[model samples]
Target: MTIIDYFTQLGSNPYFGAGFGLFGVGAAAALARKGMQVGMILFRRHYMMTLEVPCRDKSYQWLLQWITQHARHTQHLSVETSFQQHETGRVKTSFDFIPSVGVHFFTYRGTWIRVERNREQHTLDLHMGVPWETVTLTALGRDKGIYFSLLEEARSLALEREEGKTVMYTAVGSEWRQFGHPRQRRPLGSVILDDGLGQRILADVRDFIANPKWYTDRGIPYRRGYLLHGPPGCGKSSFITALAGELQYSICVLNLSERGLSDDRLNHLMSLVPQQSIVLLEDIDAAFLSREDTAGVKAAYEGLSRVTFSGLLNMLDGVASAEARILFMTTNYLERQVLALPLSWASDPFEHCSYYVCLCDNFI
Candidate 1:
């Protein structure tokens, strides 16, 4: 072959591509080996809070907010803004991280930290790559203190969203969240009632909080359960909401008709009741009324909830039920309508009638 043709043939040889491919593979392998060694060092020194812990999980969201507020000067970042209509009829705007192409870094107290989303686990994984010898225990403690301060700041933001409002919470599936925010600014003094019931209810709650030891000493459960029954639209719900505001307690409204509300789910929801909050179980008789029952029942009530009458009783008297400072069950039924229902639904069978407080004459 001619010399020029021979060189052309050499350039077109399969080994030319193979040689470049081998060089690329070798480079990637060397970089990967180096990365593995660095990763091992990091894995040894890293402090990770995974998805399992609830508080830790919430801290991820808090940390995201912290980074957003403090890391605005970052040259590379993901930032997003959103507007939501709150239950108070107010529009709320929120800023979030939009997750850029790669790791986003922020410096806290001269310590550089990286935040990345762990999509598989659905959590935020934070990494600080300081050498173990360089980070003293005191420095670590300072870092933790700053971390908790961020958590508290996030908590305060959540509280600010709910300030001066009465929230009615209900279960959707297995989760209980704020169902609605009632705009009723009706104070307890404004609730029109007879028989000194308003004063009596307020005094009862004050006594309970003031003398928790009294109940504990007597081996009595530190819980107060009230049954409010009256005609429909006679301010039963409003009265309860007013009472919540008076006590400065958030109201959690439990609707047994909610889907996916089995006995276990109901019990779990009740167990999570916030300290000093009022749990209102409205329409007590209506929840149990099915298609088999007569015309007065709430219509089209088919749902996935399997909350039985016995289950309701069990949850009310259960150990965790006592965690709630007060529990209220309201109904728009007279003495006979309530008495006609099964007595086994009562926490204390003998006090079935005792729990009932007649409010037939009280109006809004």
Candidate 2:
């Protein structure tokens, strides 16, 4: 039989023809998919503008907060709830919804924006102990200025949300992370310090911050340290928190007794403290007894903390220490054995008197 006649006979068979039809359909579908992918690549390259915010970036939270407040078309959602208890025995509950791991769409200034929230299951943020995530904002047009405007707006909203609030931060690994939602600012009057002591300390801090130029001209380190020593429950910590609120400054709480905290890490952390923040070291006596006893107590305290007395001293006044910084060290005991080292380091030591009194009409 001729070749044409053999092909004609095979076409007449139902199973062969069916198989051949299915093969052609598969090939066509694959070609279409490839073409579509190429088209999308071209579109994204030429027409789309994108801004990617990683989970580690400060802008990540701003963008997420903006999306939660402004994005109207988000379908997939993640909820964050916070509870606060008032002194009057009332509890306040709040719920916030953000875009989940998916694509969402919203409009801004007559422009359609696409947000893609992605989480990498296999990757983890070592510092935060959470999965890695990224939020990509894509717009149809290639105007970079629009993206900048969007980001600025998001930042403004975040600032407004945190207005009149005191943000608390803590050391995570070698970096500082926000501890929780910003707390309402406590009035300095609420803290009852003896004989205008709160006002005196507040004025001193304000003067130090305001006279940076004087410090620079005088070749001073532009740093200050305050020691608040008193018995427990004397409001040493409460006064510091109130002082931070008065100055509109964040608090970076540092724990010197944390395990695995090395001298190098301490130096690094001190050098890179967040702007307009007070570095607070609570219970300074518990961290280290005395500089002279470090060698004798090394074996017993080695497992609790790796930081040495010399290292602590270096971090306090070393070349690597941050400039224009304020340090607050609190302790219950100001005895020679407990605070011998810190007393020498503290520029101004304020002794807290044990008393209970409210200065403000309404105390928090």
lDDT of each: 0.60, 0.80
lDDT string for model 1 (23-85, tens) is: 999999999999999996666456432122132233444455555667665555566777767
List of clashing residue pairs for candidate 2: none
Model 2 residue 223 CA deviation (Å) reads 0.6
Which residue pairs collide in model 1, if any?
none
Count clashing pairs, candidate 1.
0
Off by over 4 Å in 1: 1-68, 74-103, 118-143, 160-163, 172-175, 178-186, 290-299, 302-304, 318-324, 335-337, 340-364
Best by lDDT: 2
Highest TM-score against the true fold, candidate: 2
TM-score of each: 0.65, 0.84
Tens-place lDDT digits, model 2, residues 255-305: 888887889999989888999998898875666654545554445433577
* Candidate 2 Cα misplacement greater than 4 A, ranges: 1-33, 289-302, 336-339, 342-364
Q: How close is candidate 2 to the true structure, as a TM-score?
A: 0.84
Candidate 1, residue 318: lDDT: 58
